[model samples]
Target: MTELTVKKREAVGKKVKAIRRQEMVPGVLYGQKQKNEPVAVDKSAFEKAFLAAGETGVINLKIEGADKTVPVMIYALDRDPLTDKITHVDFYRVDLSQAVVAEVPLVFIGQSEAVKNEGGILVTSLKSLEMKSLPGNMPKRIEVDIAGLKTFDDVIYISDLTVPKGVEILNEPETAVASVKPPRTEKEIEAAKEGPAEEPAVEEAAVPADEEKNGGQQPAAEGTERPSEEKKADA
Candidate 1:
């Protein structure tokens, strides 16, 4: 990656606004051996760098009045929320020989058989990774292979990545990066559309109506003669 240098800035506040009006972004740079310097860069140039190298690329920053190149990273950017126009930027000082930690985006490549052929969803847990590397050795982005995913249980972990040389991933080795999950099938959709399941009806207990109507009626004693027999003898 090459460096980009901006001219030294002289204006502030309203002057900065005027610079933006002229399609320029006001910026500042600070380094270990260098003092805080105000600079202004062509908006188009900075945009191109961001578009091509992303935020993690090692940039060669050429600042006005400095004969040598300063290794730097795009540390901060302020932009209009609605217009998405660059308002201001801050560049951080970086040493080329020393390793620096940066967050790099994760790019998943290839179509998963589980999602495309077997009707599954691709679940991605980690969208980016933290890595430490020297400016010149920084990678554009980490590429993860998902072409072999075959089932909901299929997953890719940080340990499975073949990281490029001179870069070390800062994430835990067991972290899940991507996975193939079973999609909601037609049956599941129909079940959802049907709403809650119906509960089975309970049967009511039956009461003996005859026992209730003949409240205290009693049966004849086992060894005693019936009252009808006694009545017949008397007659």
Candidate 2:
């Protein structure tokens, strides 16, 4: 478990900006049975703890002046669009005895024979898996072994995944997680390189019926001065 210490925050609204300028991040902690508490943490410290615990791993959050540390998980984050800096965060207090659902990132490991020997492309359909487990039993990430993908026809599905005894995957059992795709043929590769077939050259704009009746000259488009207006301007 990762441990992070934060101070109770008094700043709110525009005053919170001052805390951020001091290299602190403002956040709130809340849960089913817990009171919403505003806190501030050192930006660098929060980053390190987040990297270690992610969203699934349990974190021991200590609040200044509090008697006991609270077990929690990062629930959400807000970032500055231009700088991509963390602006605010939400922490969900967790009960060790209760079960919770969380999405665990999937990490692909091992080489596929189809990709290495048969020139097939490895395609993955899932990037994460939703799982239910006690906070203490939650895994930071799930490893997916791709070595079994021996051919283009071979696929790994949710039902095939192995996890800890207390953890239950919530996704449909038949969902395909990974597979090997047949490599593109030479002709197909060339066509892709040439880009989509030149969109059939837009047929020349059809001559308007009114223009056809008035001879070859196209009528002035709407919003533009007509020949008569131009003649009047010249006069």
Candidate 3:
């Protein structure tokens, strides 16, 4: 477990900004049946601890003037939009004997024969698995070997995973964790590279200038006689 030392923080509201200016981050620690305690830790130390422990790994948090250290996990974080610096944090105390739910990242190992020999694509449906285990039993990450995927029809499901004795995966047993997809045909690859075909442009009918001026009424043809001329001829 990683160890981090923090001090009791009296800064609150706008005064918390003063703590940051001094290279300290303001945070709160709380858990089930636990009182919320405000604390401050060195920015550099907090960052190092966070990187090592992530959100699931337990940390031994030592508070200044306190007799004993608290076992806690990083619960949440607030970061600056521009600099991505940690502005605030939350810690949750954990009981050593109690089981905790955490998401463990899935690390794929080994190359699949389908992908290496048959040129098939490896598709991973799950990035992580939610499981319940004691903090000490919780693994940093779960390793998934893809060597068994020798064909496109082969699939690795949640039920196929092997975990520590105390860890219980919460995902459905039928959930597919990884699989090999058949390679795309040459035509399909070409179509994807070219993208969708553009639609044909519709051409507007050409209108005579005279018809436009006369509210879309076409003029008489050269050989066609006007109403007045026809009347004169009949007379």
Instruction: Judging by TM-score against the true structure, name the best candidate.
Output: 2
lDDT of 1 by residue, 1-235 (tens): 7658699999987778888888889999986677898899999998987776667876788877878887788878898999988889888888888888888889989989898888888899998999999877778788888986877777899999987888999899999889987779789999999999999899876555754564634544679865675798998
Per candidate, the number of residue pairs that clash is 3, 0, 0
| Per-model root-mean-square deviation over C-alphas | 8.7, 11.1, 4.6
TM-score of 2: 0.81
Total residue pair clashes for candidate 2: 0
Candidate 1 residue 65 Cα shift, in angstroms, is 3.8
lDDT of each residue in 1-235, candidate 3, tens digit only: 7999999999899999999999999999999798999999999999999889988899999999989999998888999999999999999999999999998899999999999999999999999999899987887789999999999999999999999898999999899999999999999999999999999999999899989986687887889964675798998
All candidates in order of TM-score, best leading: 2, 3, 1
lDDT of each: 0.84, 0.93, 0.93
Per-model TM against the reference: 0.76, 0.81, 0.80
Q: Compose the digit string of candidate 2's lDDT tens values, residues 27-146.
A: 999997768999999999999999998988889999998889999999899999999999999999988999999999999999999999999998999999999999999999999999
